[model samples]
Target chain A: MFGLIGNIKAVPGQRDALLAILLENAGRMPGCLAYVVAEDTADAEGIWITEVWDSAASHKASLSIAAVRDAIDRAKPIIAGFGQFIETRPRGGHGLAAIAPA
Target chain B: MFGLIGNIKAVPGQRDALLAILLENAGRMPGCLAYVVAEDTADAEGIWITEVWDSAASHKASLSIAAVRDAIDRAKPIIAGFGQFIETRPRGGHGLAAIAPA
Candidate 1:
């Protein structure tokens, strides 16, 4: 699975707004039908978001879309750094959800 | 961070229902300020969920709560297998969101 792992920081009191933006975008991304956002339960200021798209191509295709561009733009300052990964399970229990084509 | 990575399968033709449950619990989890969901980019049948919690204790505490228990109960039969991880980033380009104590 090609996962986008973004390191984003929440505004001191506007974390909820950032979350709303994330929810809003996740619900709308065609290529990204599944998007997950989580935070450091203790620190409240740190947030981590992991998202999977239909394919690497579909995810790339989404970058130019208005909604995506806007979300990123709105979130740019909030993000501390960006990390992206295209992973294939190497070992361990029942690996990731990289399903085979039908 | 103590992250729960479950290898849960979606009921045939009822994936949306599972997604709804995830959304519901995520919104209510006291220790889980962030929850993100994603599916395999190409395969329609595969799904992957990654979640982070306040602490191992907070996550464990949440499981006993009504919302979490109900989510698990309602979702267990649908799950194909389960995988749990308590991770300390071995190394990477800017690691996880494990914040320091106040």
Candidate 2:
């Protein structure tokens, strides 16, 4: 499975707003095995998004969905930048549907 | 729920060795909701471990389990260092059992 782990840095004091947008759009995409958004404990302006998808294509394709596009547009301003972006090959674990290792 | 995202840096050319130890211990803890290990695309020596648990205490308690402790011992030598460790509070998302927002 395809996986991504990254930190989204919100504009100072805009973390919650960015988080709201993220949570609102969570789990609505096709081929998404998991899409978890969490509040970063140390960095007040940072949020972590951990995702597992069936394939990289599915993840890329979700970008064209209208609601996802809208969320991105809405979040553009408050998004200061992104950091620690890493692409991964998920080999599955508990709470996830069984995924054959790639 | 408790969440953690971090990168484990393995000694040169030992990523797969470290990864083997991690994968061997995956998902056996009682309160662990998810524990996905992945190969970092950008860093040849890096592995990302994304974890979610029922609570922080459960995560801490896991360290005491014989199997977990043994895995840690086996992994210690090949582990060069750690990076980007972040604690998080997970609200909920796809593939996770429903978690009440904390």
Candidate 3:
């Protein structure tokens, strides 16, 4: 499993628009097992995303998709700073035992 | 479960030290099911964290501990913006089926 983690900033009032973009490309993205977008309760302008993909390659490939590209382009103008993507693997938790190997 | 997500910035020269503080309280933090601190591959100074807890109350209580307090206090100077915390529950992927009912 792979992860695509990002720290996003929504424009002064473009929060809804940004969320829509994320929703748009989700599910359709190959290797996407889970996609989560979260808003910081204390700071509405800040947002966090956690995605699980089949591989790092699939995640990179998602960037080239038309819909994904468009959404990212639109978001760029409103964003202040884009952090580098961090990749992660699930470490612990029996709650995720379903993910155990056969 | 609950979540404690944050966007943390380590001082220009204090990344390793900040991580040490987190490591110190990690195992001891009550109700802390998982605590993750990830750095952005593209931005050396940017970081993302995702924490899962037993409950919101337990997460709050963890903050009152001496170790947690020291870590937070040490890291605060390096952090830029402390967003309000947003809690989340795991949603999908059979991988997490282990967390389901007995």
- Which residue segments of model 1 deviate by more than 4 Å? A1-102, B82-102
- Using DockQ, rank the candidates from best to worst: 2, 3, 1
Best by lDDT: 2
- Candidate 3 displacement at residue A45 in angstroms: 0.4
lDDT of 3 at A35: 60
Instruction: Write one digit per residue (lDDT tens) for candidate 2, span B1-102.
Output: 899888899999999888888987676787888788888888889888888889999899889989989999999999999987789987666666443223
- Provide the DockQ value for model 2: 0.68
Highest DockQ: give the candidate number. Answer: 2
Order the candidate numbers by TM-score, best to worst: 2, 3, 1
lDDT of 1 by residue, A1-102 (tens): 356645456767666667666655554555553355655454455555555555667668778879879987887676555433323111111112233222
> Which regions in candidate 2 have their CA more than 4 angstroms from the true location?
A98-102, B97-102
Q: Candidate 2 chain A: minimum summed lDDT over ten consecutive residues — where?
A: A93-102
Estimate the TM-score of every prediction: 0.45, 0.87, 0.51
Cα misplacement distance, residue B7 of candidate 3 (Å)? 11
DockQ of each: 0.05, 0.68, 0.14
Q: Could you give the candidate ranking by lDDT, starting with the highest?
A: 2, 3, 1
The worst-scoring run of ten residues by lDDT in candidate 3 chain A lies at A93-102
